[model samples]
Structures are given as C-alpha cells and as structure tokens.
Target: MSVEFSVFLIAVAFIGLVVSIIILLRKAMATLDEANKALAEAREAVRDLGSEAGSVLGHANDIAAQVKDKIRAIDAIVNSAQDVGQILHTVTDTARKAVAVLNHTPQAAQPEYVPTNKITIRKTSIDALAKETDRI
Candidate 1:
C-alpha cells in the first residue's frame, strides 16, 4: 500500500480501540456504583441489628441483677428462720431438764369434747400426743 493510506488505516484502528475502551470503562463505572449502593444498605441494616441486640443484652443483664438481689434477700430470711428454730430448740431442752431435776411430774391432760353437728366425728384426739410418765 502507499505510505499515506497505511498511515490513515493505522489512525482509524487506533481511534476505534479508544472508543471501545471508553465504552467498557463507562459500563464498569455503572456496575461499581450499583455495588456501592448495595454495600451501603447492608451496612445500615447491620448497624440497626447491632443496636437492637445491645438493647436486649442490657435488659437481660438488668433482669439477672434483680434475680441475684432477690436470691440474696431469700438467703437472709432463711438464715434468720434457722436462728429462731435453734433458739426454740434450746429453750425446750432446758425446760425438760429442769422439770426432771425438780422431780415435778406433769398431770395427764384430758381431751375436751366439743359438740359438733357434723355426722362424721373424728375418732382420733391430738391433745394428748405423748404417753403418761408418772402422773402427779
């Protein structure tokens, strides 16, 4: 081919390559924008979920603290009841010992009969629970 024709053909090919590259670059840019928007929406959703999860955890912690406080109060009450039971046990033991030392016998108590209109009268009496021990 002649030199001018060869130069003109090369120039046309170079221009066509540049136009194709520009079109590809524009499509790439549009895809990148869409991807960026999707990422932003996902980030916002994750942030909202994290805040709600934190709030739920805080409420659970508060409930656990309240349960601990109630358990402590119940423990104190149980300890006081045990102390009272110990004191009563000691007093009853001391009284029984004193009665034996003095040789004082307790009289047998008769169960009182209360008249009732009910047809099913109980045959058992709970007033005298122990056997007679040297009645005075």
Candidate 2:
C-alpha cells in the first residue's frame, strides 16, 4: 500500500477505538450512578432501622428499671411483714405468760371443778325453774 493510504487507515482505526472506548465509559458511568443510588437508599433504610432499634431498646430499659423498682418495693414489704410477725410473736408470748400468772397454777397442773352437795342442789332447782319458764 502507499504510505499515505496506510497512515489514513491507521488514523481511522484509532478514531474508531476512541469512540468505542467513550461509549463503554458512558455505559459504565450510568451503571455506577445506578449503583450509587441503590447504596444511598440502603444507607437510609439502615439508619431508619437503627433508629427503631434504639427506641425499642429505650422502652425495654425503661421496663427493666420499673421491674427493678417494683422488686425493691416488694422486698421492703416482705421485710416489714417479717418484722411485724416477730412483734406479734412477742406480744402473743407476753399475753400467754400473763394468763399463766393470773391463773396461779403450773402450766401442766390446771384445776378441775368439783361440785359440792349445796351447789348440786342449787343447780337442780335452777334447771327446774328454766323448764317451767320454757313451758310458759
């Protein structure tokens, strides 16, 4: 081939290669833009999910604190009840001792009643009077 014709053909091939590269670069840029938009949407969704998780954790912490407070209050109530029970036991013991002293007998040696002849006669008369009153 002549030098000028060969040079022209090489120039044409170079231009075509440049055009093809430009078209490929443009398509790559469009694909990159789509990927960037998807990435941005994913980041926003993650942010929303993080915010929702934070709110849920805050509510759970509040409930845990309330449960702890309630448990402490119940513990205080149980301790107070035990103290009252101890005081009641002391009072009961004191009352029992006082009754034992008033009775003036050993705890195991309580006296039994023995009716005399006079007491028996009075009881029989009272019973007869109650029967007559019931009839009336």
Best by TM-score: 2
Model 2 alpha-carbon miss at residue 59, Å: 0.8
Span of ten consecutive residues with least summed lDDT in model 2: 117-126
Candidate 2 residue lDDT tens string, 8-116: 9999999999999999999999999999999999999999999999999999999999999999999999999999998777665655554454346453276546465
Estimate, for each residue in 55-133, the C-alpha lDDT of model 1 and write its tens digit.
9999999999999999999999999999989877765565455434333333224434546764322222111112112
Question: Which regions of candidate 1 deviate over 4 angstroms?
Answer: 103-136
**TM-score for each predicted model, relative to the true structure:** 0.63, 0.65
- lDDT value for candidate 1? 0.70
lDDT of 2: 0.76
